[model samples]
Target: MEGTPDEFGAYRLLAGSVVPRPIAWVSTRSPDGVDNLAPYSFFNVVAYDPPVVMFAPVGVGDDLKDSPRNAIETEEFVVNVVTRDLAEAMNETSATLPHGESEFDHAGLDRAESVAVDPPRVAAAKVAFECELYETLEVGTSTMVLGEVVYAHVADETTTDGKLDVEKLDAVGRLSGSLYATTRERFALERPD
Candidate 1:
């Protein structure tokens, strides 16, 4: 725990320690028009007002992962929220497919046209954010892609009083290797002014 661990070791440590991270079920399209869908646990909202988010997709060996690759090339992506209902389909898309293969097809999920970006949204997803690429930072072996959310679609049931209701949203979270968590259990706290 003192010195730097290998990439795999560090990844294991980080994933285990992060504790219930929000998943970004990202969708992008290859230059040849092949649709791609993959889930990233290394994802979170970076800022509000302007509405920014980031996801770090690590390279497989030396090659950039398809999510970051397509986002970088196309300058567009869609972040779809994962729910218990869509867990299996989201996991299915994580398989390593050939560059031109479409995960949306592999996962048997329907694609809806995004309002702002070229990449399609998962029609089964309760929430989807269409984003334009803001920047990408080359980490050690991973690329951190930041996107500016330009549009969002939320299912009518997922909202309450014009705000997102976490209990109703029922979004899934990443807990380590094969583990996932739900948003059913939560608590609220008042901030000190």
Candidate 2:
């Protein structure tokens, strides 16, 4: 762990230590009108005041990923949360299809039109954020795209008195290689103010 590990080694270390990572099922429409859907485990919310989220999509042999490319070209994308029930569909969408291929069709997933963005979202997602491209930072081989969420959708059943219920959400997380986890475990820690 002291030496500068190779790219793959570094990724393995991080991916293993990260434990459970939330999945960002991103949807974007290419300029040619092809709909693309992919899941990025390197994703998280960066800010709340302006409602910003970021996802790092590593290049495929120095080639730009379709998600970042479409976001850059159209300046819009949708982040759909993956529920446990939709795990298979979410995983299916991650297949590396050729450019201009529609993952919505490839994965047999339904597309729901976004309100404020041109890209569509997964019809079954409990939560979806319609975001506008805020900035892109080239972080090594991966490109970090920041998006400013403009419109948000949340299923009524997933909330209790306006607060998210983790049990109701039943989201899945990525764990190392092909492993995945559910949010069924519970623990709590109060922040020391």
Candidate 3:
């Protein structure tokens, strides 16, 4: 906390210290009609009122990754929640494929039509958010994309009386490096009034 940490060191410290982070399984469509899918650990909800979410895409070297580039070009994307069951398939999609190659096909995942966005969503995803590009910011070596949800899809079994049930969601989270966490263990605490 005293001196400035180097780039790689700072990234390692931040990522390692952040504990478990939710993964945004972002899906986007390229201008040439290719579907791109990838998982981003640097993602979270930004605003509840507007249903806004953000995901940061850190490019390799000087090349912008396909997901963010597609979102920027099309101004649309879908955020599919990564559950425990979809963990392996989600990781499969992270492999770097040549431009215009469909990760869905590579991962053997079926695609579902999106209502408000051009990009498709993961058919097996229990929950998905169709979003329109709201803003984008260049932060250091990553590009932060902010999107407003235009439509949402949720599995009926994951809901309790029309509301999402956390236990049923079975979401997975990213830890440091190749480690991951699940929602199997949970504790609720009462907030101060």
After superposing candidate 3, which stretches have Cα over 4 Å from the reference? 1-3, 60-62
Per-residue CA lDDT of candidate 1, range 1-193, in tens?
A: 3666564487788889888999999999988899999999999999997899999988733488888889999999999999999999999999999878899999899999998999999998999999999988888878889999999999989889988877798889999989999988899999999
Model 1: which residue pairs collide? none
The model with the greatest lDDT is: 3
* Candidates ranked, most accurate by lDDT first: 3, 1, 2
TM-score (C-alpha, index-matched) for candidate 3: 0.95
Ranking of all predicted structures according to TM-score, beginning with the best and ending with the worst? 3, 2, 1
Task: Please list the residue runs of candidate 2 whose C-alpha ends up more than 4 Å from where it truly belongs after superposition.
Answer: 1-3, 60-62
Listed in order, each prediction's TM-score against the native is 0.93, 0.93, 0.95
Distance from true location, Cα of 86 in model 1, Å? 0.5
lDDT of 2 by residue, 1-193 (tens): 2766564498898999897999999999999998999999999999999999999999733487888899988999999999899899988888888777888999899999899999999998999999999999988888899999999999999999998777789989999999999999888999999
Q: What value of lDDT does candidate 2 attain over all alpha carbons?
A: 0.91
Greater-TM-score candidate between 1 and 2: 2
Query: TM-score of model 2 relative to the true fold?
Result: 0.93
Q: Give the Cα-based TM-score of candidate 1 against the true structure.
A: 0.93
1-193 per-residue lDDT for model 3 (tens digits): 5666674498888888797999999999999999999999999999988999999988633478989988988999999999999999999999989877899999999999999789999999999999999999888788999999999999999999999999899999998989999999999999999
Candidates' lDDT values, in order? 0.92, 0.91, 0.93
